[model samples]
Target: MVHEGVLVESRTMRASVAEHTEALDRAKTLSLLPDGMHVTTRMVADYFEVGIEAIRSLVKDHRAELSENGYRVLTGAEVESFKDLTSLDKYTGRHLALFTRRTVLNVAMLLRDSIVARHVRTNLLDTEQWARTASTTAPVDNSVIHNLVAWLDARIRETVAHQLGQHDARMTRIAEDSVRTVIGQTVVPLLNHAIRADDERRREISDIRREVAAIDRALRARMPVGGMAAMDAMSWREFEEHVAGLCRRDGCVSVANTSRTSDLSADLVGRTADGRTLVVQCKHFAPYRKVESGEMQKFIGMAKVEYTADIALFVTTATFTPAAVDLAVRHGVTAVHRGLLERWSAGRALQVLR
Candidate 1:
């Protein structure tokens, strides 16, 4: 008979080569998806025709690059949530599918129009003065970027929590799907717009507020137990709470708000962990709004006398004027917009915090 030891060695070599080939295939596939595609283990199995056990080996061999490029190795609630939402329609079995579809389509159309407007304004950025002035080809400021990302995460969580609490599953899911579409289509160009808007960008802020209100209206009208106004109020509260949390985390200690009094000096205030008090002015503008230079100047003034904080921060869901940013720098204040916040909170950067 052939030598048993030789036979075992041959088998081991074959297994190793097969594993190498499988790993290379997975790496190639991962390179194709966006950096944001949070695919699950099951999806990987389905797509790659591999066993769950094999996935571990493949991931281990290729994870360094693949994981960094958005093929995250998920577990715990992350994996579970991704699996749960893969087929959201399954949750609609007990409800009227037709009603759900209509609501979703209407919300989507409204969001689409907003996206178009956003795109038009953003396209103006390349020629805009502010963006060129503020543009930094180097890596951005890590702390400022992180604060913005955390702020956006708080906003999304607040919005989702409010929607879930106020509306039935069908309507809530519809609103979510619609919002996703709008973000995908509008957000990129909107960033460009935010980057470019000079002194005139605050007009865009008004537009954003209308868009935000529209989204709120579409989602709130589907609330199961409350009037639309009640639902809207709940969402606004959640939004404020979320903003407050962002301020607290970003070295602002005692954050508060006064949309009621319209006192713009310091809507929020607190101290950094180092005992340096900080003041924050918040603007939860609509989807198309841009904060003006005047507001930035006002925050600087507030920081000097009223708030008496060590630093001033302006946090908004909209863009800011380049002059506003310059003014903040001159006055030792920080201005943060939504996109930076979203990326910091939900993007790869947050991993460092953990």
Candidate 2:
């Protein structure tokens, strides 16, 4: 989904900041207290000079120790989990998911520079540019730096929204260090790999399309004659409803035959909540004939004029030519062959299409 303004929502940013700050405060407080002394949420809150609510949240959110029985505590993998808990939120997860392994690492370094910038009179641009240079060891786009800056800017806005007062110098230092540690280490490295993985995913999709085209050709050459009579007898409206139902069941939203023109008109229009609209041109062609991309393009052109859909879809009881497949991709249309069309029509509305 596309996001407006700063990518991360304000609440998540504040949660990250608060969780980091409290974690640091807890660490320092633990170090100072006697060996066997108990640490309650109240004591931690009092120590940090924050509310009890804040301390309680930090313990749970950061997954840090809560000193049960005043001495015994979680350790080993548990300790590591706490350390990894700082920026565990949806936006951060999405960022990690999208960025490459190297890019994530670079971002973490950039975040460190940004945090330091917050404390000093150092130039923001220069600090980030330096971080990017150090991380990549190559010329980097300043926009990447700017995106990190935007992230920081959003956090600052979040801090304000939470009604959190001005941070004391000690608190600021704790926050800056803690945030840098989490972002630079865990989040950054993971995201870098994610970026590479995403590229790989797109390449895989391209390969699959090629394979599918080959399969389509084989299937088109030998159409199933047994279903022809049943399909021909079914009205277009019945088939449209059947397909629309299947799409809806698959978590897709669709509009069908709103204009109610001839059989050649687009039968179904599908939309995702994210504003991805696809106009479906359904053709119940004779089994042996393969539909050409020229016909698909013709539908796409009409769809743009009639439905103004961002995407065009051709679903037919026939395969499309290789040229049609190429044209579909070039024009951002999707061509679904007869087998897929049959799958889209399973029952009551039109069992014949299946």
Candidate 3:
């Protein structure tokens, strides 16, 4: 009975060895890991040619064993430190889970549902056995041994160079994609916002222009025909006020009479719609009287220097002398005579003597 039991045990052991050998042969045909043995959970999934969720499920089932071996969750400064060490910007954040070689092997051993994981375990076992045998084996011929070593060294260098080139190209593509995404997210919105603001401003300016046109039409409709002739009958102060009123009706904003002060060269000061300072001098004279060149020259000097007026107007109920008209033209002064004053007071557009 003892002899029969020993024979049955030997057969069972042989069968187990045959099964393991077959698994190793099958694993050799599969790509179980990347070029480098170091791996993340995603990397391991890619190595086994399985979905990432499948690897995650495996990890969830055998978390304790994997953690005890080499599974680690990097936190705080460790996350930054690991990214720096790997020279990978994509790895830069807090609370990242990393898997070492031992952790991967442990997970593979514990996985019952994944054929890929079983293949990975077999590959790992074959690799370990090969390493041990290679270490123990002695070289029979020195020349042959040296040749084999040189060939292996060259192959290793070639593989490393190829992997590095691929890695650099992938990183460049990732960087370009990231820049495009940022421009789409940030620059496009900013440009749209600027366009909208500019359009709104233009609409506001158009509305203001329309309103000003309406106000000017109303002022012209309200003006009297013989207003300047009527103004000639008033006092000097009243004439100044009349001129100021005409200026206000003619689109002069902030019009104020300053005729009471002898120190001021202008009877009225105002600003135009286009933000220009307007200086006006009212001359309430008789119809036949002519404004002299000397008065015009003095007023022109004051308007240009003291008040820094963009436009200067000399208004008279009478007309201007030939010399005075010449002087006003030369100094860029507007000499408004009886006809223009009448038209202006009646709310017609002022036609200055150029």
State which candidate has the highest TM-score.
3
lDDT of 3 by residue, 1-354 (tens): 122122123433222223232342233221111112235667667656678898788778767756776677779998775554333365555776777655654555555566766665554454445445446543344455457546655654565556557567666556555655665587657656655665665665567567757955774455444554366677777878888877776677998877666576788898987788999998888866888988998899899998998889998877777678777767878777775666566656654311
**Candidate 2 lDDT over residue span 221-335, tens digit each:** 4543223334554567655565566556655565556537654457777785455675677777665578876787778777888778876767666566767766765666656
Stretches of candidate 3 exceeding 4 Å from the true structure: 1-226, 351-354
Error of 3 at 269 (Å): 0.7
lDDT values, one for every candidate: 0.46, 0.46, 0.63
Query: Each candidate's root-mean-square deviation in Å?
Result: 31.2, 29.4, 41.2
Q: Give candidate 2 regions above 4 Å deviation.
A: 1-233, 262-265, 343-354
The deviation in Å at residue 97 for candidate 2 is 35
Question: lDDT at 194 for candidate 3?
Answer: 57
Each candidate's clash count: 19, 11, 0
TM-score of each: 0.32, 0.31, 0.35
Q: C-alpha displacement of 92 in model 2, angstroms?
A: 32
> Which scores better on TM-score, 2 or 3?
3
